[model samples]
Target: MGESRERLWTRDFVLLTVCNLLLFLTVQMQTPTFPAYVKEAYQANDFVVSLVISLFSLAAVIARVFTGEALKTKSSKILAIVALGFVAIFSAGYYWAGSIVFFLLLRILVGIGFGMGSTTFPTIVSNVIPAKRIGEGMGYFGLSTSLAMALGPLIGLGLLNWFGFGSMLIVLVLLVAIIFPLMHFIRAYNQLPVSSGNAQTVTGIRRFYDKKLLLPAGLNFCLSITYGGILSFLALYGKEAHIENVGWFFLANALAMVLIRPFSGKLYDRKGHIAVLPPGAIFVGISLLLLSLTTTESLLLVSAAFYGLGYGMIQPSIQAWMVKVVTPEQRGMANGLFFNSIDLGIAVGSVLLGVIATHSSYSVMYRWSAACLLLFLIVYFLSQLAAAKAKKAAVASENVGV
Candidate 1:
């Protein structure tokens, strides 16, 4: 009976999860603080600071395009190791970046490593888990990022205050270095079948991008724009507002996401997007709106909680939806495309919203972000309605033929 049962936990899975956690920790640790670093270090303006953040996403997007296409031919294990090496190397480069141009170059390199590593790791997880439990497994896999998000910035900020920026860089380098040895233990990398999609026949850009995954990807893209605003500017916002405990926003956000994630995936597996997307999007919208109005520490915390719950529910649900809808062969591409959308959103959000904040105020920028989420709801519903119509038409034709 035990042998007959599907396994969710394995040594490889655990190691990969830890590796993912470490990788994301390196990324998240700098999310709220990198702009500050560029500002203090280079005396960059808001546009320049936002560019630093956006460049990472842009590089990640470009890297994923190739990463997705290479999944079929590349050894994911090797890819992961190499990517981690780049991450560690560039992470240390932070200490040497004396100019804005040099720092931007390092950020791009870091994103490239991160892009390849992120794609490879998730594909490896998909291979290791029971096919029937993709949602649950991915949800659990996602916990690494969630936990990192919760803890990374808090740790980064603390280190910055207690020690210095150089200390933070050293710690990120160490975190990436720790994962290097662990990658050797992951047995699932070469064991599982690559996605069923035919990579050889599809040449050029089509090989890297998948259109089928667009809906959820689009939704994720929209939501992540708001998230970019939070990640890139929230610390600055707190400083401007005279709020001392701005970190609480991320704390509340991360905790809520962790609490909801375990079950949110299960909900998606059982009931589909209707059970998750609309409610999740609504929560996200509300959170952005709340953030716009936050004048007190308590209000900021409340906005954080709402944003956490909203983002937590929507992100995994969209991911699971992307996986479920695609053929096993397409999982790599789907994952790549899905994540590409997320990075694209972050890139666009950081640049666009950064401009808005420059011209207007952060409060105005957040309110506009909240308004954009309302458009997410509209897009989601329209997509669902169109999908429903297509399904009904197909069903009617089938019945008539029968």
Candidate 2:
């Protein structure tokens, strides 16, 4: 009975994780490669290159609104299938992209599909996970995403170099296509809790965006901004710095993420975000600083390890914190909003950092990325102080009445 009460590794959860892993793997593989591709193929500038990531991300943010609403009462099966359809079809469409504009269009359409798939998988998993272990389960679930982010670029750049862009797209297309059959095994699609978010009295824009999720969502946004810079320019930066095997940064980062994720997730569950976030942010900030100043492969990889450690700790804490604050019904919106923050951050970071790189250098741009996290720390501490004051006031009021 006790085992069942805390079961975090059910079949449903595993399948969801795999589907999400594949979905994101396909997406992240393109993240670092596309900028270089757009530059070479289209003779594009930094602004146009920024559009490749930002515009696609904004489209996904808008699409997730509909996805969140649909998941409230509709069949998650239908949403998942439609999302897969968009991905498989549009991914193959990349082969026909004769111009950069056309390719950006494809990215927009596919991101909508991504928004649907990304939201549905988490909503279903949030239900199936034993409520007692939401942090651990989500941390494990998050591994699928972090791992994809970690390894996809190394594989993507390899495919681009060894074969060609066309062959790389073909591989990613097949990778995405594989997810279709796996959907049949997901049995938790229809099992929703009775106390869903729809029961709350939220109205208008608030219906889709919850106030409770704002602070963590903001912090998550800042964390993703640093990564956004990495995704948009690391490949290009490799050339700028004359580094031959920059993919090693991602490989080394992946190793660190793999080692740290389990322990960080358990720490969040036992001690809360206080035990995890600040130190993790410090690791991320230091990594970006070191990466900016690094001139050799050894130093580059050391920076990657620091990043992986911080990112491993911080990302899951923000995600689990959002999930814990909302109702079962609102989990759809929570997940949607959670992802929206990430995509939006990526979008903003890509453009902002792209401009910095245009005028200065990628190294300078990374320093700016590190500085953005200062906003994260400031927002987090302010929220904590407010909560503490509110708690103190409540206690004082109760004592006077007594």
Candidate 3:
């Protein structure tokens, strides 16, 4: 029976994994290209380009808050399908966008679909996987995004070279179209039994925000702020620095993340977050700082390696930590909150960093990123101290009882 259960669980995980990969591929296919498209179409300035990058994140943040509520009342499978349909429609629209305004508008609409679809996968994963394996599973699950991050843009660029931007957009649309049919397989994964009680009840909603979970969520926010800067402006920075083969930097980062994720997941499962998080944080900080100082392409690739390692490790650790502290029934909402925090950070970072870049040099942006990382480190240590104190108190209480 145990073996049978394991097999069933594995099957479910596989299905969810495939779905995540497809969704991430759709996301990545456009992410790196969108800014270039906007720049070319609108002759946009820094602020406008930042807006183009941030619009999706802002919309996703707003959508993430409410997506949890919808998850409770509706079939997540259908919601996912609807979201993918939006992605397909909006992606196709890119081909026909006559003005920068139309492009930006479609990007915002894409964010809405992205928000809904992105949130559902993790929620489904949490439901299907066992509690003990959640961290490991989520770590493995994140590789889907990492993989897409690595390949999607390269593929997009390749398509662009061969066929043009319109053709690349068409390919993305077609890829997105595949997701609707894939929803059938995903339905089985979502069918894992949910708790009988109403998740919408006041008490249930209150329980979703575990104080212990907030530490990781906060960390997620900070980490994403740093990442958002990279994602939104790396291409621009590369241009400023006169770095050739800028796409390789992204590729290197994604490849490093893909290589490191499984190990990081296992480390998180075995060693706890304390063992995994700080080194990763330090590496990330150093990477960003180094990126700020670099003029050469070689150094930029070095920064990518460092950043990728740090980001790959930190992301899964925080995600695992967030889900680990929550109850089974509240996992969806918890995941919702987790993702929303990320969106919030990304949205803010993209907009603010854009403003900063406009006013100053790109190098200053990295300096600011370093400062954010420092702040994150401080918060992380404080959380560790608080956890230690709580542990000591629990030990004392046990001793007293004895």
Candidate 4:
């Protein structure tokens, strides 16, 4: 009976995880394919092609601000459904978008729909998973997004190459439409409002940005910068390094993530972020160093596994930390900021590392990218120091009063 309550694979949890997976698949499938489609179909230059990617992400990041607030109340059932349906509608509209302007507008609308749905799904999951198993539950759920990230682009590009852009849109619409039916049967959204406490008092913009989220979000941001570099430049790096079938890196990385996530989560559950973060950061930094000099496909995949293992450890730990620190009602906001940091970091990393690559080599760029994690380590340790100092001071104050 005790084990039953501790269960992480309840029906609704699985349903919500699937729903999250499909929605993210819908988004990520577009990530790599859209830039190509826009350049070819519209004969767009670099700036316009860039907009095809950035605007959707920027809009999605912005949209989460409002959607996160709405989710602070009753769970995001209605918001998510409406937003997802809105996404499907806009997605289908892509077939008829006459100009690049029209297509970009459609992308923003879809991004909003995506933003709303993304925030709601995690908030619902946070509410549903057993308190003791939040780390494990979120780790399992995080796999959906990670897997989609790994698979969606491959699938999207295949659909684009084998079929065409229009067919891909149709498939995407149908995929999202399936989520609507699934939502009806899902009963996992049990988030009650933060009825009392400081949560009730905070209003307007302040309510949306919780200070407690800053350190975790910042660390997540730093980690994402390296990922952004990978997403934006790994293929180019493959070219530079003269490695054939560089795609194997992602394959190995995905495999490593699947293997490592559960153990990382369990470690985090038992020993907190300290157990997970330091070693995870070391693995990632070492992975980047290895990738910098990777000359063979075998070495490339080995580097990927290290990266996957480190990332699998850190990301869920940060997310679970954010969820644990917040009140139940604030989970949506926490999740929103969590995702937004990733997007923002990715954007920044691409631009920052691109400049470095322009001046130096891809190998050098990767070296600099590893330095982001060094910053991650420095910031993490400093925060720990500050927290310890605060705790010591509080203890001394109590002793003095006694």
For every model shown, what is its TM-score relative to the native structure? 0.90, 0.91, 0.87, 0.97
CA RMSD of each candidate after superposition: 2.6, 2.5, 3.1, 1.4
lDDT of 4: 0.90
**Ten contiguous residues minimizing lDDT sum, candidate 4:** 190-199
Which model scores highest in lDDT?
4
Residue 309, candidate 3: C-alpha displacement in angstroms: 0.9
Superior candidate under TM-score, 2 versus 3: 2
Clashing pairs in 1: 195-329, 196-328, 196-329, 197-329
Find the number of clashing residue pairs for candidate 1: 4
Ordered from best to worst lDDT, the candidate numbers read: 4, 2, 1, 3
Instruction: Give a tens-digit lDDT track for model 1, residues 1-402.
Output: 655436888898899999999999989888778988888888899889977778897888788777867777777777787788888998798898878899999999999999988888888888787766777778889999999988887788888889999998899899998897888777887775744555346676677656778788889999989988986789788877788888788889999999888788888777877998888888888998888888899999889888888898999888888877766656677788888888878778877999999999898899999877899999988888998999999999999999
Q: Indicate the TM-score of model 1.
A: 0.90
Candidate 3 lDDT by residue in tens digits, 1-402 = 865543324766777777778877877777767777678777888778877767887887777667766776678787787788788898788788888888889888898888888888888877766665666778888888888878887787788778888888778887777666666655454465456565445555564366767788888898888878987788799889888677677878888888888888778878888878988898899999999988898999999999999989999878888877765555666777888888788877877887888999888998888788898889989977987999999999999999
Identify the superior model by TM-score, candidate 1 or candidate 3: 1
Question: What stretches of model 3 exceed 4 Å from their correct place?
Answer: 4-9, 39-49, 96-103, 193-200, 203-210, 239-242, 351-360, 394-402
Provide the clash count, candidate 4. Answer: 0
Instruction: Provide the overall lDDT of each model, using Cα atoms, as 2-decimal numbers.
Output: 0.84, 0.87, 0.79, 0.90
- Most TM-score-accurate candidate: 4
Per-residue lDDT tens digits for candidate 2, residues 304-356, read 99999998899877888898888777788888989998887877887899999
